[model samples]
Target: MAGFDDITKKAQSFLQDGKVQDALKSEKAEDVSDKVFDGVADAVKKVTGGKYDDKIDKARDEADKRIGNE
Candidate 1:
């Protein structure tokens, strides 16, 4: 599942970067967090041809939790 791991890592990076940008733009943290999670989920779904919906949803949930904690 190296490919999946790579995709997850990349998604996380994208979320983190978006968070930073959002913060700079004075966006609410909660809103930014949601946007990041949704964006990642959509990207994962597109990349996997919609074959890994459960995994993507789980990843997005976990990422949201992690981002919220930060």
Candidate 2:
């Protein structure tokens, strides 16, 4: 299981480096939040074998909402 701190750090790096925009572009901006969320979710799922699927999904939804609001 990946630690929450590690996940957060990775996300912070993405934001700090402006990689989030790249990701959003790659995802065609369908839903910036969903794309970003799914990218992280998929990575976590791959590493943990779906152990955090639900949490990731909810996180993604929240992220999507936040992005939409921004």
Candidate 3:
């Protein structure tokens, strides 16, 4: 239910949190990133009345694919 920026901040904090990163190590990075960011994008789209939906969604996808695949 949080906004896109909030989600992004949370994700950044998650990466810096040792325990969370450790837990994430057991999962597929690409799958996890995609799932998480995709949800963030959806939430953002819902709140913004679709004004920036395409751009936000596209950025989310690119970030997910690029970062996850790396």
**What are the C-alpha RMSDs, in order, of all predicted structures?**
9.2, 8.8, 8.0
lDDT of 1 by residue, 8-28 (tens): 998888767965656644536
Better of 1 and 3 by lDDT: 1
Q: Model 3 misses residue 16 by how many Å?
A: 13
TM-score of each: 0.54, 0.47, 0.54
A best-first ranking of the candidates according to their lDDT comes to 1, 3, 2
**Candidate 3, 57: how far from true, in Å?**
1.6
Between candidates 1 and 2, the one scoring higher on TM-score is 1
Prediction 3 global C-alpha lDDT: 0.77
How well is each residue in 3-67 modelled by candidate 3, as lDDT tens digits? Answer: 98899998898788987655555447767877789899999999999999879978986776554
Clashes of each: 0, 0, 0
lDDT of 3 at 35: 79
Q: Give the top-scoring candidate (lDDT).
A: 1
lDDT per prediction? 0.77, 0.71, 0.77
Error of 3 at 37 (Å): 0.6
